[model samples]
Target chain A: MRDVAIIGAGMIPFGRRDEDTLMDMLAYASLKALDDAGLGDKSVDAVYVGNMGGGMLQRQTAIASSLVDRLNLMPAAAETVENGPASGGSAVKNGLLAVASGYYDYVLVVGGEKMREVTGWRATDFVATMTHPQAEYPYGITLPGMAGMFTRLYMEKYGVTREHLLAISLKNQEMGTLNPYAHVEMALDRGGIFDSPHAIVNNPTSADPLHLYDLCPVSDGAAALILCPLEMAKKLAKPPILIAGFGQATDTQTLQERDDPTDLKAVTLAAQKAFEMAKLKPGDIHVAELHDAFTILEIAESEHVGFFKKGEGGKAAAAGKTRLGGQMPINISGGLKARGHPVGATGVAQVVDIVFQLRHELPKNRQVQKAENGLTVNFGGFGNNVLAFVLRRVQS
Target chain B: MKKEIAITAYKCKKCGKLHYPYHDRCLACKSREFEQIKPQGNAKLLTYTAIFNLPWGFDQRFLILGVAEFENKIKAMGQIKADSVDQLKVGMKMKPSWEPIRVQYGEDVYGLKFEPME
Candidate 1:
């Protein structure tokens, strides 16, 4: 099989975008990526759209076909990928395999979710649909509820505290201010959100242990990438970022079924497979973007991915180890906490942010100096499904 | 008459791995054959949370939910009979009951419920 490389990446700002429809967001991001690749008059071989709630929220389906037609890219094969929150990563994986197999020379992978169009309650219910129909959904278990339980367990077993969680919340939200594309631009203050007398009102509990700030906001946005053979990418003007390795894994549908509920086995397996295929260890990674849908997840995934020892991830964040220019700068784009998680768009947006870092195009604040390699973890269905990718900047 | 827990747990005949809510194949050994069994005795609370921002269907301000492991090792999720998460603790004993967890179309949906047992 041939190697796949990303030639171009594009993303629109993430927030409550009431103006753009799901198809419009996908088409806009795709056009930006196509233009970024300098494919002015050229068309892709196929199109893959990643979406989770088009039919549920917008009453629209077959988004890939709609996007291809909207972008005037007729005749190209079109397909939509849905894997809960990992839809974007799954779509990219499809595009990568298609290009690597030599079946499609150029593939456009776009992920977008117009979640803001629906009420928060509806969105929460929609996301909860991923849970076990019989065992979990009936219990009214939302994602935050799952995270809250996980957080409680982690605290009891690993000694993780609210202070450690606060560190990530502050750090990521602060980074968000520097990110123009971030949905939450306001930086959180310790006094206002935690220490002050009015803290109760400021940061009310959404889930028992996790507060409002601990969870990511519902957002509407889209991101796209243009992928081709590594050989073909070299001919392009922009430096190519090779998809060095990728891995996808699944765990039990219900967390209670796992022997150890705190163990995010799928995350460990997926990251391990990606690292093994890349022939690189976690330490070798220059920058990383973890799926931080909840603050506790960032800590848990950081440990599961081998960035830190188990039980140490929370402390690491509290000590500034995961901050930009620190030991391993994570989520320099503000992560899901601040950048906003538009489910389908998040996986693609993570890669797009990394591409900017690897390309050395971002302002010094967000860019990792002379970064060579980056990694991304896109989590789905709680920890039931996960995907990991290792990207390397090809030195010209 | 006291309501009996209606849940059925399948034990993998090959590997002895127990499963709740019925799995087509055993998760550990992938055995096609299994011994059906009922969750026996009181359970231990494994984890729990009180969700404040509920979904569209739930009208209550908050709902307490948890997972518990029974004497026979049949683990399942259920609504916790507690005023708050403070009333629940991991590893604490819990009495499991079959009762209405929610209402759908004016019909009660019966599921597992756990009450703390001192």
Candidate 2:
């Protein structure tokens, strides 16, 4: 096996993109990555597209092949990977291995989801299709519903409070104001969202215990990355970010099947494996991006991934330990909370954000000071499937 | 439509372990042979959520879903009966009852739901 490095990363602004088709968004992001790689007219060996609801939402399938054709990169091996919301992470993992094995020198990985084309109810139902057909979906369960239950349990067992959740919402949204590519660019005032007399009317409950503000927005966007063997990456104009380690794990399809409902076992296992392969501990990571589809998820995954001790994640966030310029800053890209979650695009966008941070290309306010390493956790199917990646900056 | 409220599980002939919502083969021993067995009624709730925003097919304004550990310790998820979401509590003992859990295909879909035991 050989080492693989990300030579280029690109992202389109995330929001309700009504003007672009799924293929168009994918092609644009791919072109941006190709341009960033500075490989004018250079051929890519294969293309992997990560998408969860292209068919259901756009009535389109075979996106990878369609994208390669759209970009005039025909004859390249094309495949679409779908692992629910973690599809992007899964695609990158495949591309990483393909390049690492020396079989493919250049692999283009792009993830995009155009969900806003459908109604909110339809999108909610579409995502819930990942749940147990007989046990969960039949009862009208959605991702927010699952997160609400998990949050309630975490609160009772771990002593997490709404105040802690409020801190994450406030911080991420504030950071969003600084991120041009973020879906939500407005900052949240504590008084408006929580302390005001009209708070309940503004941030009504979507799921009991988890208000609307606590959940990520359903977004439409795309992100891409170009991967190649580390040796080839050395000659590139930009500093390469090595894919040091990646791990994927699976749990019971239904959260109830697990012995402990609050425990994200897959998150813990995948992070541990990634750390072992990277030869770096969580403490060594200068920046991190956790799956924050729900604010509680960011908190739970932080602990499960060893960034904080169990039950301490919420407190740590409240204390600004996970904010920019703080000790071990996390979600400096604003996270899924404010950056938006276009399911398939989220995982790749996370890596792209980390790449920017490691390369010191982000604005000073959002950049982690002298960041060298970053971590990302992309969760799928209510923690049933999860992927984690550890990336390091290579000093040329 | 009338429905049975009882919960049925599959017991592996080779390993003697049980499975809920039954699988094709025993996860423990990979035994293909299994026998149907009804789970014990004593149950403890793990966690639950009251979803106010109803999905496409569900008719209820709010759906109360619960995850519970049965006497056999196998975890399962199902809708729970409650007049209000506040009445539901984690770790509370409950008994199963039969009712229409939701409206599907333009008709009520009957399923077993747990209720706080009197």
Candidate 3:
């Protein structure tokens, strides 16, 4: 099989984005990537659009085909991938395989979601559709509701405190201030969000044990990457980032059905598989972007992905071990906590950020010094469907 | 309203693993044959949450959700009923019962709910 390499990465600022349609957001990111690749008039061979709610939120289907036409990349093979919040990661996985198998020369992968166009309640409902219809949805369970329950279990079993959660919230949001495209760029203050009596009013509880800041905001944005065979990337303007290895795994549709829901077994399995394929251990990773849909997730996923031992992830975060320049440097892109989760866009956006880090293109403050290898974990559907990727920079 | 919490579970004929919500095949053994069984008696709550953000059809100002482990390796998610949020705790014994949880599509929906075991 041919090796797959990323040549260009692009993303739009994630926020309310009231004016842009989902297609428009997708096209803008795609064009940026194409321009970055210096492709000029060289159109892509295939386009894979990762989207979760275009049909439900935008009332538009056949999005991949629509995006291809919109981008004037007609006749390029087009398909849409949907795997809950991991849709973007799944799309990139498919793109990687397509290029690796020699079936496609140039592949364009983009993920975008326009959730702010609808009411927050509607968007919540749209995401919950991934849950078991009879077992979960009928009970009025939402993603935040699920994460809150997960956090409670983690706390009970692992001794993770609200203080640990607050650390992730404060760190990610503060880091968000450095990223031009982060949704919530303002740094959070402990007094306003936690310490003071007005904290309750300022950061009302969305789910018990999880205040508003613990949860990622509903956002609208898009991110894209251009993929080609490693040999082809050598001719590109930017240094190529090889898709070293990837893994995807699924758990039971319902979280309760798992042997140990708090274990996040899928995460462990996926990361293990990716590491094995990459011939690299978790300790070898220089920086990481974990799916921090909820603050607890950043902690839990860090452990599940083997950055820390079980029950030590929260402690690691509390000690500032997950921050930039720290030992592990997790979520240096502000993560879903402050970067804003546009569901479909999160997975691809994660890879794009890692690509930037590996290329040493991020600003000094945001960049991991001499970053060589990066990891990404895009979680979906309460840990039911998850995708992980190991990327390494191709040194000249 | 009389709420009857009758949960249908399936024990894989090959692996003997039980699925609470029920699946067509056994995830462990890939066995398609299964026998339907009812999860009985009380279970221990694994964890819970009080969700202040209600869904589209849920009218409750805040809803308590819990996951409980039942007999024969069965696990389920249901509403947790209590007088005060303080009453709910992980590892506490809970009894599953059917309760009116929401009104959706202009119809009352009933589902499994958990309460402190009597």
- Candidate with the greatest TM-score versus the true structure: 1
Query: What is the lDDT ranking, best to worst?
Result: 1, 3, 2
- Residue-level lDDT tens digits of model 3 in A73-136: 9899999999899999999999999999999999999999999998877888888899898888
lDDT of candidate 1 at residue A80, scale 0 to 100: 96
DockQ of each two-chain model: 0.82, 0.66, 0.75
Question: Higher-DockQ candidate among 1 and 2?
Answer: 1
TM-score of chain A of 1: 0.99
* lDDT score of residue B111 within candidate 3: 86
Higher TM-score: candidate 2 or 3?
Answer: 3
CA-based DockQ, model 3 = 0.75
Error of 3 at A146 (Å): 0.9
Query: What TM-score does chain A of each model score against the native chain A?
Result: 0.99, 0.99, 0.99
Hey, what RMSD does candidate 2 come out at? Answer: 1.7
- Candidate 2: residue pairs that collide: none
User: What tens digits encode model 1's per-residue C-alpha lDDT throughout A1-396?
Assistant: 898999989999999888898888898899899999899878999999989999899999888988888888888999999999999999999998999899999999999999989888899999999998998998799999999888989899999999999999999999999999899999999999899989899999989899999999899999999999999899889999999989999998888888888999999999999999889999999999999999999999999999999999999999999998899889999999999999999889999999888998999888889899999999999899999999999987
On the 0 to 100 scale, the lDDT of residue A315 in model 3 is: 94
Model 2, span A68-161: residue lDDT tens: 8888887899999999999999999999999988899999999999999988778889999988887677777889999999999899999999
